[model samples]
Target: MKLRFGLQARFLVAMALVLLVVLVMLGVLLQRQRLVERESEALSSDVIHQLVDGYLHGQGRELATRLADNLANPLYYSDLDAIGSILRDQKRDDLVQYLMVFDTAGHLVHDGSAEIEGYGQPMGDPLAAAATAAAGPHVQATAQVLEVSAPIRVGSERIGGVRIGLSMAVAHRFEQRNAERLRGRIDELSQRHQGWLALMLLALLAVLVAAAWYVQRLLVRPIRQLAASARRIEAGDYSVQDHGDTRNDELGDLVRAFDRMSESVARHDRDVRRMAYTDALTGLTNRLAFRESLDHRLMLLRGSGRQLALLFADIDDFKRVNDTLGHEAGDEALLQFANRIREAVEKYGGDDALLARFGGDEFVILIQEGDVRASATRLAEVLVAELRRPLDIHERQVFLGTSIGITLFPEDASSATALMKNGDIAMYQAKVAGKNGFRFYSRAMDHAVERRVHMEQELRGAWERGELSVVYQPVCRTSDGRVVGAEALLRWQHPMLGTIAPSVFIDVAEQSGLIEQIGPRVLHAACTEAVRWMQLGEGEKLFVSVNVSPRELRRGDLPEVVAECLRETGLPASSLHLELTETSVISDELQAAALLARLHSTGVKVWLDDFGTGFSGLSHLRRVPVDGVKIDRSFVADLQRDPDDLALTTAIIAMAHSLGITVVAEGVEKESQYNLLAERGCDLVQGYWLSHPVSASEFTHLLARRMR
Candidate 1:
């Protein structure tokens, strides 16, 4: 059980018990000494009475007759010198206060001394009266003396008592002297006992003081130190001094244990801080730490006239490696990448540069107190080179590259977040320029990013705001110069900025994921327009080819969307042709083929749009199940000017025809281009030579003209 009372309390109680016992012993000793004094006084008084009795009884009768005759007639006994001499001989005795004699008749016959007050008359003293009344050996007391009377009788008769007077004052004086002696002796004894009592008290006091010191050293002081240590721990000072190690006691053990606890607390605090700031996988500073470090560096550079540069290094095509090899391999690749970058930083930028993992596939670095841009660019080059080295991940060789973007303090950006953002923008510019490259941040890039962001935000609401529309560019048969179909091109008419071209917004739409929303609207509008065209009494079959974005194709819902558009517009699927770019259908070949086959089964014609422009080849025709290919306008535009263009276009037409695929010639504006395409047996031609892109109303008139 825990101690309910403190050490001091228990110690005080023990001392009090000892003191109480001592006091009880002293009181008993004093009372016993007082009782012995009273007993000794009573015994001395009895002895004094017995000695007086013997003195009176042992004296001879002659002494009594002489004293009696002298007392009977003091005038006549004035001649009795014998009695005077006897009385005078005992006058100075300490036991005798006075000496006197009385007649046998109890009358004063002769005064033994002339100094007697009632001489030569009857001695009417009370002692003599009591002695006479007693008759023989009568002991009586006057106020100051005891009188012993003896009858001078021959036989048993009493003559007159010879009264001998003894002083009661003398006995009282003796008793007083003895009592004083006894009191002095008792006082002496008490002083000695008092000395012992004082010693005992001193000893008790010394014991109490020693106990207090022991408790203070062994228990109180250690407990106080422990409490102080705990307070220091609470105050976050883990490096407390150790005070418990010197003694070989429980308190010392407790102090040592507390020291261990303090050490553990300090270690745990360090570990928590490290985990918070460092990445677990790579042991590099994490994003939060990066931001904090950047802020700190900027503060340090504020007045130091030093510049800092931040670099954002993004691993290019890391996703491909991750998806192909698995996440474990991905983690290993990241670890290796981190190691290489750190090495490059240490070599080129030194310890002043900070390296951290911003997150998956992205790392950041800061160069401080130096030529920021120049050093950063040099370090970026080295880092790119280092990261390009092949890594062994899960025993599989993998090659990776880095694109770095640099932004400087007080130049490209003034704040940490701004610097990081500018760096990110420049990094994206490097990716856009080409992977495995680096770029320094420019204000133009910042403006461009801002513009892109603004356009993205605008494009998201463009469909709902009626800013988006479909412009149909007529497609004609090259042989007859007649319109047979039109390609649906998207246009953005900004409410404030007038009309925007597809090139301006389509790229932004694709990047911002807004293209998915725009794609369905375009399909629906084109289908509705085609149905409207059929409703016009032109009496000709006109196919509407709507372009599809790659993002829309990758969505894997293009077939369903097209079917819904057809169902909503009540347009026959055969009349609605969905044109997909080569890049759109080539990324996922299986999904693209499946989606295309499904669309084909729905009686919808799938044309490969911008066909000779991308990485797709004639083999894609055999695999993608497309009904036709549109020759890119770049090839068609330079038909007469560039012989290579004419040759490539002619070869495309031949290969497309060989596959029994329809050939659509784009951007055929010149007569020479059109004549050459006709000579090459191109199936369809679309360009400004026939007509620029027109609204549905204008296209209706064109169809009316063609029907006429």
Candidate 2:
């Protein structure tokens, strides 16, 4: 069936036709009025120009120029009164708005109108030495005025210029009178057609009334009902109500469909809530649900003097299981692990406990009431013990341990977010102290973390702020006590905190990922300083060793970063040594060897720092491509006092020598330790016993002394 015109379509078409006719009539009337006004304005402007030019010609150019110059002088107020009187007498049709004069030097000498504010100013642009009027009336302040300018001359010499501004009020008055007559004619014409137009509008209005009534019955009533029903549905009122549109039409079908959709939405709502709050893998509460529960619990426990404990539990070495087994096994392990935690919570935490899985192998447990230290500790121990049991995953046994961090509500933190963060920090501490343990949140930890966060922010701008500097500790030849090289130690001088130790900020930088940015800055600064030292005679052959963190080495760009620094500073790579702690390279020997090989390729020396202090032994050391080993300070600090330390240091130096690698002894604080290290065939020794770390300039002076 073909569709008929709706009530809305017919109504809009009738109204649009009427509006178009009305607009056309008004447009024609306006256009005719504009043309009449334009012609009248041009004629009036020409007449005004002739009057002003005749007045200036009668005054004579020399006398006019002199009078204008006097009038323009702001200091001569009496001259302005005289000029204003002369211009006022010359005005015939009350057309002149203002008058101005410019001297031969282009300085504005006179302004005659009270409307003009500035006098005795330079004329930015002078009209040619001729009479001319502007194309149209120019606006000044509020009213439109015409401007005409002519040269003021003495015989043949042009002395100045005179300008007259004519007001457009007279011309505008004539245009208004014509506009009024045209408007009256338009009104009479409109009155003549008013009856017909009204009849047409009345016919349209009758049709609109009829259509509106029909549309109200046929469409609008049902749509309004459906909207009301939708609002009820949105407000979670799912009960089916009578739609009241019983006509056998599409509206009736739509009402029925709407009823069905409300039922479906109600069903989906439950599923959505479950999906939002529950983890799919373990069917346990998710982070969102945990946070909600935590907030509710915190509100209830606030000021009650009652204690609540939040525990953050993490699986130990979960990544190893994922790597060794398959991802499927990892998923299975997480499920089993979550189940164990749930079991433990049931056993020790009682019915008041709320258990949630924070994704992956991490879970959280809340005890509504508990002893701050004692009860929380017992619950954590139970969970750790329960998680230790082997799980049968795909017929293979898998063992796991958990670390728990516990925080009390009123004591540790007041808000849900702070409580959760404190628990997380405590959990990290437990893992750090060794997994399969538990730690309670303490203020000391918060202070340390806060300090870390503050330092991280400060260290980001430290290099740019010039707060970081390199201090050189002299490295000497053990054989003859002659200086060979110096280790560059980084120091931070915080504006507020004074001098901060390297250990504190460096650890923060590594954790906060700022180390990547700070490392290259230190490297460049040290290289630049090293180049300065290398210029000195004794330090020319001396190498500057810069410490590199594991993060920097893992980036795979250390070679490029170091090379760039060397290239920019003109420091030979061979004279710059990159030092890495044994822990940095011992984890992945192959990757470390690749990185060291690249640096080695650049003619830079690589030293395994803190030797024998890390996990790797001499066999692993032989695999790493390094040029030397630095004996850890622990051994050297005790070298003279402890027989075992002395034996260990001697053996390290001997073995390193046998492998064609040099050995540097660090922390030789006492003369005895230094003498003993020298006797042990150590190649280089660096410690306070000889000289402490000094500033760049001071190191330069030390190099000069050694040369002398």
Candidate 3:
């Protein structure tokens, strides 16, 4: 039957409606939360201000009324003492602790309670302090900030005002009411929203049921028919016809198209079978079908776990086939050679074995046997015997020998790649020993991986012998010819080798797992020196930045180290910056993201060092909090003369500004180079353009000279 709306269209509409409902719910929830927060803040502020104002106005009016009464109708010391006692009884209960009024002369006139009347808590005449329309009530002392001042005006004759302070004991009573009300309202609103959500979901359920029935009838039926036909095709039966297109809908059109596809599929399958199962030129079983057949045989023999020997055979002196008989004749010789290998394997290795052209002029065979060595020796001899056969190619009789490398499986490794690698290594050994022969693999190759271990041991000692030192390159600001920060670089001054370049030792440290020790020490030393200078009154407002490597960042405790160093050295976080290589940020994306997040949390500035050298520059930057980018010396070294470097520097500066990160150009060797960086609007410029690395004392002296 024809349908007005198809199953796919119904599904799309259902999904769209569900998503729209979800978005609306989320928006409504957020709006409600915002409104509640805004209302609570406004109410709390109004209560606090009104509480202070009411108390102050009431106390001021009472003080004035009592003082005028006391003056107009004389009172004795006996009555005054009674009033002081009354104020003491009332101070603790009401928020009004003590009320005092000062005249224009800073002399206290009327005091509320005896506790503060004589002690004098710095209350002067209210008339002396100028009144501003925008001034809000503020506290004079931290412990007494709860107290508030309310100004009172009486015509043009401004008199003294009262100051009343409320203790912090009433916080619970005031906040509990607001919180309870909010929770109740939130719960009620949540329940109503949940009911609305359930209604919407029930409506969606009806749509789902109708759509499921429609799909079962229209789309699923035709697709199910196609799936059955596909299974029949896979089972080598192409007799099924496409009956999916019995109607005029989309599926019916799909079924009509499928009928044409089956014929082409049958033709391609036949061609692929001939090409894949049979060796194209030699007409032997090709490697693809050969491996499949071997796997099936292996499955039957799974419990046996008997010895399986693999032999990797290579053409001996095969270059002669191409050199003596041209490439076309060489192709013919290779096919004939493959035929001979099959015949040999069949004779010595039996029909149960596997024979395949492993790759390029090489072939592999697997055999199951009780005595692996015996089978290996026989297989090798048979291959040598078959390869001795003569090939007649274009009126020439050419003879090619074979070199075979045999390795036993289950004794080596059960994995295919490992067995292949072992066989290939043995084949190389056989060829090296002498061609036209075969050799079995032995287990002595583990000793070959020891040289790398020895190098790591030496690196551990190098850092312990006072070999590590820092080189500071000034990162100067352009608006003025002043230095803002310095990039800390580590250099190793080996006793025997003079000065070693970082490129050489850095990789050694990374491979040797020495970065964990080296990275922290460098950062700590840099921070210590910067702090020492600041304490000595030499370096002020100078930030020292150290580079963090990926290995160290992952393995080392950077957050604790950064915090501890800042605490230990007494250096402010703003004075210490961390420069991370962009490669570190991109290598392990997740760890880089988490590590960068943690580092940023410690309040230290982070710089993407060597910014332009990494792939996914912009994407990685978004995943982390970055304060700046350090343009690598690699790009800046030739910027004065190279147009590409100049353009890149300009673009980097602009990109950094767009992201709100500062950009510092390194390797500015000349004044003109520095000028170019400054002209490009770089935030900082470093390198020899300012000054080379100096000792701590010399740097301090230089700072002193510059100040002079």
Candidate 4:
């Protein structure tokens, strides 16, 4: 029959071997203990003697060095009384046998005596030569004494030396006493160790027997249960339970903790999944979840002759609301907008439709069940109308509108990424045509988007390539038709595209954050050109008007930028005019007013450009600190025939003059328009009838002509 060596049996065998080894080791240890103790006593005596000798030497050296430093000044001054006093003080120590001071010539000056018997006598000791020659404390031991010598120096020159001798009698007695004590301790320890060994053998045997039983009953059984539970958890089973362990021990605590951890993991898994797929603000599907669903639907609809529509919606002028009000109001607006969109989608879109908040102020919807185009169109229309309704935010009614773009699957695009791109392009087309409407994706829209992207890329480095230049349009006194100043206009002549208009590239620059860089360059160029025109005018004060973008004004650096330009170009501040539109100032009237006030302090003029085109109210004129207003071309185009245009123009000039603001009419192409503006007391006029925008050199010629 085969015998099984279970845990208890193996433990018993191991314990027996250990007990046997312990008995043999104890016997051997007892036998060798006496010899080791005898040898240890002799070795300890030697070590103690050596340690005592070294300590005497170190003490002698330290005393000699201290004596040398004290005697230096007294020896230099030849004060024998001070030297004798220092030696006597050092000799008070019990270990110090003698102390002496020597001159550089090796003569003993003081030997710790009142009579100074060795004074001015040559040192006859063998160590005298080494003491005088050494730079630091030196020690040597003899049969009865330890001798130390140290040099005394004033600055870098050695003038004398000090010597000290310590007696060996006290050190020898101390060594002998320590050796006797050490022997007594060894004898006592040997007896105690023998008794401890016997007791340990008995205690170890008892513990081994008890451990075997404990392992079989408590440790092994609990460990096996824990291992089974771990295996279950590894196999995706999180339902863990404690097996009724009543012991208040680490094992019991671990079992309870494991159960809690399993429950926590299950709850966290659900929370993580929800957070990954849902938008926290709107409770709608997020972009990741929407994209995943779109891809899955596309796979199922493949080769099934079915279609799907993806619509992209963006809130129009949403940033304006955020900038004017706070983000809390913006969040409230978004929540309300989302609720309205959800209602509209439920009404128009079929059951299979999915809606998602793609990102900030942008939402996307997918419809795959019904007629894709018809359903998307109805949904887009309903969304636009419903969103246009005023929303109550912060107890104030705020109106919002949405622009949506629609693209169909298997026709406009096949993949999710491509469909999304086409939808975005179509949405931008709607904004460009006029916001608050919808547009369907077409090939032409894609091309237009490509061109715009291309233009933006090219505009980045156009200035470095020398493709940009400035043109000047002369502003003449309407009463005399004589040039007084010019408006600096930026023009870009692309290498491939002949001449790109400011309207096209200016918007691209602003959108791409390139205007902040380009705005300063234009300011500097205009100031530099105006200085030249001032020289050409022969003492006439000719000003240059530079257009400031709304983005640049919002940055609140216009005052500093203008000051820097004037400083660089040496242009007088009064000779530079900065032009801003009403829309730019109306966005943040307080900020604009402050910026304009700062510019006015520097003597630079601020003009409200494109007036009557936006917020043409008397309150705007009162709030903004403008020095002048420019009548937009739309008002000037029909100034000759249209009664309303003429009346509005007349009223604008009268209102501006009443407030001490000058009026300049733009787009005066006909003689009749100039005559009417001149009659209306317009201060300045610039249009095709007077002269087209010309190069700087050409404008210089006109200035010279006016000078003649």
Cα lDDT listed for each candidate: 0.77, 0.75, 0.69, 0.85
For candidate 4, the lDDT comes to: 0.85
lDDT of 4 by residue, 517-611 (tens): 99999999999998887776356598999999877876667788889889999999999999998777765566677888999998999999999
lDDT for position 261 in model 4: 74
Each prediction's RMSD over C-alphas, in Å, is: 6.8, 36.3, 48.5, 32.9
lDDT of each residue in 1-708, candidate 2, tens digit only: 998675456655665666667557656755665565565455545554455445434433434344444444422343556666666555544655556665665566556566545566665543322332322212222246445555554545555556665555754665566566656665676666665656766776676667777877777667677788789878977664756556677878897787677778877877787899999999999999989988987888788888888899999767546644568988989988887788778878867889999988889998865564676788888888888777787775556688889988788889999999999988977876767899998978888667667777888888889998889999999888888889999889999999998877887777677889888877888888878877775334888999998777766788988888888999988998889988667655656778888898889999999998764467766888889999999888876568998888788888888889999988888888878877778899898989999999999899897798
Collision count of model 4: 0
Tell me how far candidate 1 lies from the true structure as C-alpha RMSD in angstroms. 6.8
lDDT comparing candidate 3 with the true structure: 0.69
lDDT of 3 by residue, 92-122 (tens): 5554545444333333444655454543344
TM-scores for the candidates: 0.73, 0.54, 0.38, 0.63
Local error of candidate 3 at residue 449 (angstroms): 9.8
Residue 347 displacement in candidate 4 (angstroms): 3.8
Give the total clashing residue pairs for model 1.
11
- Candidate topping lDDT: 4
Q: How many residue pairs clash in each candidate?
A: 11, 2, 0, 0
TM-score-based ranking: 1, 4, 2, 3
Error of 2 at 283 (Å): 6.6
Error of 1 at 156 (Å): 1.2
